[model samples]
Target: MGFRKGISILTISAAFALALSGCTSDKPAPSASTAPTASSSPSDSGEGGTDAKLEALGLDSNLKFKETRKITVEVYDRGNDGGTKPEDNFYTTYIKEGMLRDHNVEVTFVPVPRWTETEVINNYLAANQAPDVSLTYSYPTIQTYANMGGILDLAPILAENKELFPDMFEYLTETNIYWDQDPATGTLWALEGRLNVLNRINTFVRQDWLQKLNIEPPTNLQEFESMLRAFKDNASTLLGADADKMIPFSTSFDVGWRADHLTTSFMPNDLTDKDIYVNGFDDRLFLMPNYKEGIRTLNKWYNEGLVWKDFPLYPAGDTTEDNLMKLGHVGAFMHNWDYPYRNGDDSIHASLQRLVGPDAAYVAVESFPNDAGVYKKFLSGPIDRKVFFPATNKEPIASLLYVNWISKFENRVFLQFGEEGVTHEKLPDGSLKTIATTGEKIMNSPANIDYTITSNGINLGDPDLTVKSIANGYAGVDSKLIEIAHKITTNDGRIGKNANVGQIKAEDGQGQALKEKRDTILNKAVVAAVDKFDEIYDSGMKDYLNSGGQAIIDERKAAWEKTYGTETMLK
Candidate 1:
């Protein structure tokens, strides 16, 4: 079946999507009102001093407003085609309408396709037709615009409405804001955004196949190898007549997704750990000894015929692995827990369950102990992008008001869901649920906005949600897999350091180059282990450590010293 059809099976049923009656928490008792008054004057309290009269528009705040104005805004559309609507465009209509209706500020939304978000936005800005606010994903882009004086510094606005934006303000302060300031100079450019801590890679296997072979889930590396061997052997027997029928184990390496996840197995520590700085530098791109070990593991798997030879060239989103697993051909793969749950497809989940019965499971695996025994989890920041305002904006206060209006909870929800009763409903259990208003349920309906817009809050590091979302629909998932995943914590000592100084200078080009180098070295090492482990180690392993590896350690050491002082570095 086509990938789209395969995914449709997992899509939320229209009935389920529309039936949004979840429990609700009792509303909090009203507290003494200390809300700030809306003022047009630049003197409004905030980061920088303001004396100019402020013209506010969009959603009116609870605080009384003096005057209101209407403005048109162009915003990127994140909703899929099936659910596209004027109000569904959160950045354009939803936010604009909420601000205008609530705060007596009128705003108009212009939708831009995701494929042309950057291009269309830049073009508009260049043509002096910029919107009040523009959204972007990359931090570097935001920094570039901010440095060019193309965007307003929100610091003052944030300060002025501190109570109105405690969570947002806290997020900005706790995370690094991109701006340049020099004690020696005068002002620095800084960027602000949310940080995501947990890296999403995890192990996915055919749990149903495990039960068919009566093999237990793998724990350490040895057990994992044993399971792979069984998978290969069983596939050989089942497809004894067909050479192409055997699916030992496989994953796509196209676009670096599969390769990156595979490399994580050899990580001696959590990639997020800051302890193992390069020599004395803090750069993480530098090579480390553990990288060699990871490569060796991959080499071993390849030589043993555990990994598919054609993996490196597979097209992304192709059904090769999915079909194999569904047909009970492949044994295991590595992917994020949410892969099976999203994109309006649940066939992967359904196929696994039907084939395996109840043996399918999802698990997370981590590397061994480090000096500190503390595993560093990757964190995501709040600011996905810096909102850029054009220098040509006749009234920047309108933009500020627009932003402030949407920052409110009610406005945010409106931007996410159309009319609550129409698009969704609160469940008896208080949990929010999605509902399909149209004939077809949108894959990422506004009801799912929390996942797409807001950063994971309490959901971070949660294994249960992980399993339920990814593996539960499949039959093979079990407790043993969860146990294995939970045991894998952050490793601190084995983290890699950035040592590619020459490459770093090239910016984006350098980042891609270093990644290619690392992958090449690692891939070779992994395949070599089946022949002579020693040869693999000697060739790529030693050179990587001695050259790039040592530099990384040195860099990390220096960084540690700077952060903790000379006395701590000595210890």
Candidate 2:
């Protein structure tokens, strides 16, 4: 669904870039005028004021629209594929057209080639041709851009335009740790889009095969191992010499998809060493005990042949694992809850039902208990996919009115789902359904309809609608998934709190060498401890903890005292 990162030179390069960007520079003091005021409508004049026409439109409250008489916006085109029809290409016909005709806004789509590097985009920006908005992968990237003054500090705009972007602003303030405020400057550099949670890393198994073998879905690690062995043995008996065709488990290790789940099962703690409680501080690298246990279990599983030996070499694009699962030869693997099969729309659940009747059931394993019997919880970051804007046209009142008009629920549904009678028709019941193309009733249609309209740069409609459409379906399929998703606590509770780190600025390349040296040693020691568990337990692991780990703890204590005026370390 998204790109993956590895422990490679690229990561090192990114760290170097962060260091060169002077992420540790102290934040400037907040301007006294930055405070919120009752008369702070964008129409008042100066950098923050807007015309009365725009003030009526609702643009005055949040955004300090530039004094430029005309607003021309630039955005990236992320959904273009070669052979895509204009209507079929949601970006072309819907989003751009809707914004121009309805909102009376001038916008340009800057289409970057798919799979282009970030450097290319950054270089374009450095040439004074950067789009008003751009996509980023992490908080570090946001910080880098903000440090270079390439991006806007969206906090004030977000605060003022709460009516238009209520859910989005709320989610950023309540859910995202990176967006936390800087205590010194009282400014937020960037807005967050979404968080990735553990629900997406579900485990899928061959329900049809389980029925044939009269095996129940495994609940715990012990039972899971037994089931795998049983499947292997049964396949050997059934297929004779071709028993290897019946793969008990298969997964691609290249992208770390399967590896993440296995690790999660063993070590359910939050993985990042960064202060899950603070934003801008040195990470507590390799401090979690469960990390070591997780790696050791993975090694054990690899040595025992429970996992496929060829996993390390598997190409991410190959569908060998999915093919085997479809053929009912694979017993288990890590996957999304719904796995695609040969039939385009058929999913893992549907395939099992077709192959072995309706008696088969699928189980989603969430966590495994340690010796203390506590179900260690593991969660990923929030989905940072979409963002909103405050209308900042010269006619500030007009912009606000436009935003308020669009914020209405009726307009939101239309913008998101399209004209009820054309793209979709309401069922006899209240629920909406896609219209039949050729009078043949279609149960489900592609959900990309809204993506086309919203992809247009100037449209600042509610993103919550999109989130609902994406998360609601799967959420209904399994409640536990959503429950676990909500429990995923960010490192910092919210963006305002974490923004404090931005106040501590640094010189170019000053933090680079130190960061590299720290990360290198940490990675080497952690990898060694995981790879040579027996030796590490006897020698390096204990010594490393007493030496390096304690030093990190001391550093954290000092940092905490400086930031919060407290000394709160155990040792």
Candidate 3:
């Protein structure tokens, strides 16, 4: 593609070079004009001249094309509970009307299945029918497409029009926007979306069960296991006639994900930045030092009837485990920071309260500890999803403008909260309280993240406000519990170190397949007999290393060494 006007040939080449280089800085490139601040929340009518107002803040006023330019943006079709069509809902209509009015752009949303986004996006890319703007959690997919010349290099466009995307740059900041710039060729295939929420997983136990049994919350690994054993040994007392249905600790087939808090706690405290970056491909840290012993602990629990035995039968989306939790049969689980409080009145905690009692609820606790006796959570970096454009995009600038529009606080707040009284309510405290809605006004995804493509988590204008507002999201749950859960989840959290030594080309086209193999290895090892756990785990790991895992490790190590030249860590 040719460079846009105002970006000279020298600028384009330099931008390209920066794109291919590793993410070496956390600052945004200098722009011609200062970025703009968001206006007060849009009026209820949503009738303001958005472009005129935005341009008044020093953004480029020349965004209006000579004629209406049509572009498609991808949205996740979660098939959420409310029965709203992801591509044709009230939010979509609002976006369409606003974009068309503001910039003379005809916007269309193409829905990709949330469960199979990577596979579907790849298919669309191969068919040359990918949306102009799209997103995915798989950076390697974008890298693979860029290597094949199927993706657009956005470095020049972003560099030249930094003034146009003032709000986008403001929220994403320099750190996330340029996080994936390659170190070698300087080609930016994608822009990393800002992950506003950094809360990771925490272990949750049945507080009511603990109270009924007169047991206090576990303080460490030994106490944690003792609690589970107590649950198993006293199932009849806890469940009455349904004692046989009790599951002391339950997890799913994706053991690595479900048991991450436990496994991560076992990771050594002294792993270098190079060690983290090189072996972080597994995402679960399954390959990290001492991870095997963590899984071994689970295996021992499994053989002793303290852990769920049917986890291997359930796949990624299976509801068996969730049903168990809702039925009040699961005594404990390690999952997302707010796992129990999600889904408002329909959440697992709510269901437990209805079926069991008002006091029955899952409460967050810190139990597992690393060898150093600390709960160390390996958190994701500030980046979340990767947003990019395909080569077939007819209006890259319009697409950028579209994202910029959504990144504005007014537009994002409205889209996220949806006409106040209908989908949410303005609390007396000046924070939004999300509410239940029906038909077209329902939010299919949390905070409408599927629609707000460039930003994730809550961004309610202030960091403290954003965090305080998070607890208010769970409609029926006590905000205090959510507040406590959030605190526990983020405590002792460490963002995994990444050298950003450009793309590990060996990782291209290998992520999904290797992930399946990873699940296989962990599943078999976690279910093996206690005496045979090491043998099974070692064999599975050997097979995994042979199947492209080693290639990734080798490439990552080589890339890190080449970038820093024997410096094990980047300061």
Q: How accurate is candidate 1 locally (lDDT)?
A: 0.43
* Count of clashing residue pairs in every prediction: 110, 56, 12
Cα lDDT tens digits for candidate 1, 1-571: 0101111111112112211211111222111121122221112333212211121211123422446655555544554545545334433444545565555666766666554466566666557576655555443343444445554444333323334433333334423332222122222222333333233445656655666788676645667778888877777554455546665657664322443334434455433333433322212222433544545566667887888776665433355666666655666666543343233233455455566454453335442223334433322223444454554554444554555554444544444444556554544544333344443334233233322233221221344543333222222334355344434422222322222122111122122233445455544544554667667556654565554554445554554455455432122
lDDT by residue (tens digit), candidate 3, 202-229:
8899998999899999989899999999
Give the whole-model CA lDDT for all candidates, comma-separated: 0.43, 0.41, 0.79
Error of 3 at 562 (Å): 2.1
TM-score of each model, in listed order: 0.60, 0.60, 0.89
Superior by lDDT: candidate 2 or candidate 3: 3
The number of the candidate with the highest TM-score is: 3
In model 2, which runs have C-alpha deviations exceeding 4 angstroms?
1-88, 106-130, 155-180, 194-200, 236-242, 254-257, 268-287, 314-324, 327-329, 336-362, 380-383, 386-561, 565-571
Ranking by lDDT: 3, 1, 2
The TM-score between candidate 1 and the true structure equals 0.60
How well is each residue in 1-571 modelled by candidate 2, as lDDT tens digits?
0001111232223323322342322334233234323322222222322333234332233323333222323233333312233223443344445544545444444544322324445455456554333443324434445566554444443334333433333333334413434555655554444332223445555554566777776656777777777877787653456687766766654323454444444543343334433322332223344544555665565555656656544443455565555445666776543333212224444454566455443444433444434444333334343322211112322222233333344444554445567556554534454332221221122333223212211122345433333333331134343333333322112221222323433322223333334334433333343456557533544564354444444554455557556422212
* Window of ten residues with lowest summed lDDT in model 1: 1-10
Best by lDDT: 3
